[model samples]
Target: MAGVGTVRSIISDSLGRSVMAEQPPKIVILTAPGEGLPDGLEALSGEAELLVAENGAQLRAALPGAQVLCVTDFRTNAISEAWSAADSLQWIHATSAGVDALLTAEVRESSIPVTNARGIFDRCIAEYVLGQIIAFCKDFAENQRLQQRHEWHHRETEPVTGRTVLVVGAGSIGRQIAQICGAMGMAVDGIGRGARPGDNDFGAIYAQADLISVLSDYDFVVIAAPLTPDTEGLFGAAEFQAMASSARLINIGRGPIVRTADLVSALQDGEIDGAALDVFEQEPLPAQHPLWDLPNVAISAHMAGDFIGWKRALSEQFITNYRRWAAGDALNNLVDKTHGFVPSTTNR
Candidate 1:
């Protein structure tokens, strides 16, 4: 309501033919302070007016008259703070798959359409999840530890084959995990918004409401769901207690989806065998966090979907969508603001 104005339409002329307006649409690229701008954005030169904003002040100045917002820094709150200045905003594209950080009350309640880099991260994140699953079953963590002490101790390790995996979110990333894991002879099931049978990637899809009731059945449980009101703090003591004691947990999803203190308690109490966490409630995790000292946990700096050339990939996806928008074509990865994600319609 702050940006009160009729939504601007730049896709066509009075004739209704798909065409760019006489004036190229202005695109505002938002980045974090000290972070480099996304690569390959020079492609937008001559096609549109490109403005860069690294903070709320810059963004507020850039938002007026800009029709498209490209959020390269998904973690920033600058958008929310500057939403009132977005008088001309018609679309917002998030470089990251998750748009939770960008979905402020003003942005969500507004009529502006939001899109994300959904397909861009599916394979990379799936691979990261698969690697963690292998590490846990093969005892790769212990192997590295014994090597550090220069000790040669024989030990039996579990096999990933024949193990059961439960993916808590049946989105594109989760399906990719199922595809790769199923290729390894493990059985995979998925949890989604509703129950369904005969899913292409998963053996069966169970409604999210059944999550805790079915937790004890799997050897591994993965959190790949986006962070929403329904999913935040989804995994805690009660959920951990529902899993098999031999089960391991892997989370490549947004942090805060799993409660930090509860996860620490679960690991300390041996409620679960181990965990591999890429995202956390607090980034950098603080030097003295108990999770760092725990041998059963694998920690990463929220880099699961970030691979070499990822920045360029994000830029390219934005460019592609921009072209579509200019030509009045449907943009890919459009997020449903109500649900907080692009609802998964196909298995990737």
Candidate 2:
């Protein structure tokens, strides 16, 4: 098949030993026009036949013989509708950490393995979380609000050095977040799908089911868990009510995990003091959404994990995996598709 060819290459250098030629594999780079493959990715030229697909028509046309699908435009769902044409697809790589959008019914029915850009965003996102924590503790939002009025209103700010933080995810990003928080002298506890003792940077680990009992213990409620059946709408009225009224919420995970309406009401009713939401249940949050009007809320356009050259990093990660795939080795950052996140390394 055109997309399933074996890679063939010659080895010549220091030792100068000759080997049989290897054929290149076929790879389809599925992305929007401007979001094409990153620079330096062309280095694969000698080892693979690369196809670029910019639309449903283009993707469907390329799928028949393409062995690897690289979803560079993570927002598109053309792959699901075009799956039937991907007769030779052996693996899929999503540039985004979240693969839920790419794993459609057709994809779920197929056996092709899926990989993602996982580690690339961990440090950046953890740093973003720390910034949010500091901003909230320092009352930066209120300071800005007061400044807009040209009035000097001085106030005392709470110190975060010994405050408690509850990170509701134990994946790589969560661990990084814990380490930073712990280093700054904050008490950090992590909650995971299957929680256990003695996890790094965490004072303790709590199971998902224990969120209610644990909600009141932390000054910051940080959601960094993946979107899954068990975690969807994980924080609702009951959970919010259990939290201390002075506690602030930070969500860097999928938006649906915190019920929007419930969160709004919680904030409105002073169930929680404030919130810093990076991701929302809806993208490009509607113009009239109540969250925007709230005084204590700080919102971002979902760029917490985005750092300069992130696209290139994603490309490099995929290329590293490509080498593994071509050599028949186990892939890295293998998402637990059945669970919607990477299982802890210990679990793996």
Name the candidate that leads on lDDT.
Answer: 1
For candidate 1, the C-alpha RMSD (Å) to the true structure equals 5.3
For 101-195, candidate 2 gives per-residue lDDT tens digits of 78787776778888888889999999999999999999998899899999999889989799899999888888889999999999999898767
* Model 1 per-residue lDDT tens digits across residues 207-246: 9999999999999999999999999999999999999999
Off by over 4 Å in 2: 1-23
Which candidate leads the pack in TM-score?
1
What lDDT score goes with residue 219 in model 1? 93
CA displacement after TM-score superposition, residue 24 of candidate 2 (Å): 2.8
